[model samples]
Structures are given as C-alpha cells and as structure tokens.
Target: MLTLYRPGTGWLHRMPAGPKLLLILSVVLVVSLLPAHWSTAAIAALVAIVGYTVSGLGPGLRGIRELGHQMFSLRWIMVITLVSQLIFMGPEPAVANTARVTAAIVLAALLSLTTRVTALLDAIERGLRPLERLGLDAARCALLLTVTISTIPVLGRRAAEVRDAQRARGARNNPQTFVIPFLIVALKHADELGDALTARGVR
Candidate 1:
C-alpha cells in the first residue's frame, strides 16, 4: 500500500499518535470558529505550514502532492460543491468556503505525513475500546480504517490513469470521463481486497 506515512525520527514523528490526533482536531475546531476572512484564512494557512515543517519537509511535501492528486481526482465533486455555493451564497462566500476547506485538507495532509497508518489504526482501536461494551468491535473498526487509508493512493492513481486515457481518446472536460472509470476501478479494488481478507481468515 502506498501510505502517506514517512519513516522519520523528528519530534513530530516521535510524538504519540493520540496526542497528534487531538492537536489536529483542536486546530480544526479553533480554525472553524474564526470568521471567514483573509486574516483568519492566512493564520490557518500558517498553522498548516507549521504542521508541515514539524512533520519534516520531504514527507510533508509528499503528503501535499498526494492531496493535490486526490483533489484533482475528485474534481467533479469539487466543481459541484463550488457551483452550489456560488448559486446559493454568491461568489464571495463560495471563495471563502473553498479556502476553508482547502486549509482543513492541508492540515490533515500534514498530520498524515507524520503519522503512520498502522499507528493511526492502533490509536483508533484504543480509542474505541471503551465502546466494545456497546457491541462495537474495535479491532474490526481499526482494520476498516486501515483499509481506507491504504486505498487512498490506489484510488488517486486509478483516477489519474482514467483521466489520461480519456484525454488520449479526445474526451474533454466531462465529469463522466473521470468519475465512471474511477468508480469502476474502486469497485474492482474493493472486491479484490475483500477476497484477500477472506482468504486470510479476516472474517
């Protein structure tokens, strides 16, 4: 699996996963509370940059690149969201919305850069242990998260392949050109993964 995790010994990487998750959540909450303005957006961007630096530059840039790939992969969804905001709230609000979403995404990318997927899965299981009383299977939940994390790069690559193929075939700026192929590839991946898990007695 092409994971966002980068092996490193920086302070950010050394920090416990639970605390890192909490810090990211806190930052998101704080940023969300700020009024939608250039100053607040700039501060959010700075925080994201600090997050990237603390995580280590090379890995952080990789994560950012992965995020950019995902953004382009799901351009149809983004376009729809952008158009809806423009129609309902005008262009200024749409711009602010896009900025806020982008800031949150960059912050998340930075967090994923420093934290390993396995560590994240372990943290999820630990956090959900208390919910076992409610019939939740913490291990299963963790495995699900692990699978989701592992599939991100795969989906991004598949989308890129589809886009390139469509462009070669003279398809232009159409949502179906990308979305249909991406969905098909995603479904195939899920089926293969499910079969592999079953073979391994994942139940």
Candidate 2:
C-alpha cells in the first residue's frame, strides 16, 4: 500500500499523538477562518514545507508526485473545469479555489506523513474517551475510524487496477467500466471486512 506515513525521529514524530492531532485540527480551523488570500496560502505552504522537512520529505514528495501523475492522467477533467471557470467566473476565483484546495491537501498529507496509522487511531480513541459518558464507545469508534482510513488506499488501488483492466480489454470510456466494477469490488471488500470483524468479536 502507498501509505503517506514516514518513519522518522524528528520532534514532530516524537511528540505525543494527541497533541499532534490537536495541532492538525487547529491548523484546519485557522485556515478555514482566514480569508482566502495568497499570503495565508503561502504561510500554509511554508508550514507544510517545515512538516515535510521534519518528517523526511522524500516519501511525501514522492506521494505528491504520484498525485500529480494521476491528475495528469485525468487532465481532461481539470481542463474542462478550468475552461468553465474562465468562461464564467474568470481566472482569479478559480486560482483562489485551487490554491485553497491545494493547501488543504498538502496540510492533511503532511499530518499523515508525520503520524502513523496506529498513533492516529490511538489519538482518536483518547480524544473520544470523554464522550463515553454520552454512551459513545471509544474503542468501536476508533476501530471504525481506523478501518475507514485504511480502506481508502485499498479502494483507490483496486479502482485503478479495475480501470486498467477494463481499458486493456477494449472497454469504452463509459460509466459502467469505471463505476460498476468499483462498486462491486467495494461491496465485496466491505462484506468480507464485516465478516472478519464479526468473527473477531469487534462489535
């Protein structure tokens, strides 16, 4: 699996998972509240650069490169969106939205790069512990969160594989080739995961 996590010995990595998660949330809140300005976006990018440096930038950059490659492969969609924005709202709004989205993606990716899946889940469980008074089950919540995060890469890879296979078999660029197989595979994976969870008494 192409995980964004990078094993490191930096201060960010050594910090307790709880605080790291809180930091991510704080960044998100601040970014959301701030006006979408070039200066604010540049600061966010700088923070993401520091995060990348601390966590070892090789893996993170590689992940970003892979994302770029994927986007290039789907260039038509992006081109359509850009052209539509130019025709309707002009280039400035499109550029601002693009910067905002890019900053969010980079910041979140930095969080993943600095924190392991296990640490993330542990932090989540601890954060939810306070909600136990309201009949919330922390363990189950953590497990669900973990499963959901873990499955994203799996589903992504599976969809890519299915798409490639269909393309090789001369399937047209239609909804069925992409969507139907992905849905079927996702459902199958979900069913098997549920069965495994039941067998392990996770519920």
Candidate 3:
C-alpha cells in the first residue's frame, strides 16, 4: 500500500507532487545507506527532527501531533526492525536500520499527508505514458500504483486499530486473529473503493 494523505494549507500542501516525490526519494536513499555509526545515528536523528519539526504542514503543534499519530500506528514494524537487526547484526546496525525505516515511513507519510492521491496518480501516469507503446495501459497501471499507495497508510491504521481493539477485549492477538480480520476489513475497503472508482468513471 502507498499513502494516507491529509489535507493541509502549508507550503508542503502547495508543492507539486513530482518534486515532492523526488525529494522524498532522495531522503530515503540518503538515510537507507547511512553508516551504522554513532555520528550517522545522530545525523539521522537530526534529519528526522528537522523534517517533522520544521515542515510547515499543519498549524504548529497539531502538525507534529499528526506525524506522531502515524508513527504510533507503525510501532510494530519499528520494533520488529530493531529486534531483528539486533539479533542478526548489532546495536549500531539496529539503530541505523530502524532510523532508515522511521525516516522513510515518516517522510513518505508526510508526502501523502500533503499531496492529493489524484495528483500523485496523474504525475505517475504522465511519467509512464511513454511506455504505452509496449502495450501498457498507462491509466490502469497508474491506478493500480495509486491504489497501492493510497491503501498503505489506511491499512496500517486499520491494523493498529484492530490490534488495539483485540487487546482491549483480552483476546489472543496472534497472527491468525490479526490477519483474518485485517484481510476481511481490507477486502471490504477494496470493494468500497472499487465502487467509488466505478462511479467516477475511472477505468
């Protein structure tokens, strides 16, 4: 899945999707390959702080709180990343890898928050149009990617909500319990989305 765009009236909201995407990509590249050292860790932390704090995506603290909410939803992934790295690699690598994931997730989440899904779709479609000569349905391919991107954050939120609800009820929240309901909810959302797209005449 791809994104969960939130409406805002900041500079980020007004920025074009193409450039925003390129910027995010650059960040992911930089952070993903960062050295697993203390200095790099501090740099990674600095980048993250600057990203979440300086970005005028929302009204002051409200904006920061929104990012925090998204991060909370992704707690499991971060935990697993750190744990896995710690076991297979070491503490430094664990920290570095976790930082990579967090930065990518948060920056990506920010992109989705400020930019419209339609805009992303259009940008992607335009970029891929030249490949239509190879029998590619540019529009369909774009829609597929757009849908993928759009569902990611929503699905993550759904997972978090379902997990929380199961905990609240004292139910055993294992993969089976979590996966089954998550799949069902995802299917339902897909069906609803399909109908919405059909009504809009989007093939």
In order of appearance, the predictions have TM-scores of: 0.70, 0.60, 0.79
Alpha carbon lDDT at 96, candidate 1: 62
Model 1 TM: 0.70
Better of 1 and 2 by TM-score: 1
Using lDDT as the measure, which candidate wins? 3
lDDT of each: 0.69, 0.63, 0.78
Question: Which pairs of residues clash in candidate 1, taking residues 3 or more apart in a chain or in different chains?
Answer: none
Colliding pairs, model 3: 2-148, 2-149, 3-149, 6-113
Q: What is the Å distance of residue 115 in model 1 from its true position? A: 2.6
Model 2 deviation from native, Cα RMSD in Å:
5.0
Candidate 2 has what TM-score?
Answer: 0.60
Error of 2 at 111 (Å): 4.4
The TM-score between candidate 3 and the true structure equals 0.79
Q: Which stretches of model 2 miss by more than 4 angstroms?
A: 1-15, 32-63, 66-114, 151-154, 170-173
Ordered list by TM-score, greatest first: 3, 1, 2
Q: Write the per-residue lDDT of candidate 3 for residues 1-98, one digit (tens) a residue.
A: 23576677778788888887778778878987887876676776677667777667666687678777877887777887899999999998888878
Candidate 1 wrong stretches, greater than 4 Å: 33-44, 59-77, 144-158, 164-173, 196-203
For model 2, how does the per-residue alpha-carbon lDDT over 18-110 read when each residue is reduced to its tens digit? 887787667756665656455764665565455444544444475456445333333433445556766887666554444454445455555
Better of 2 and 3 by TM-score: 3
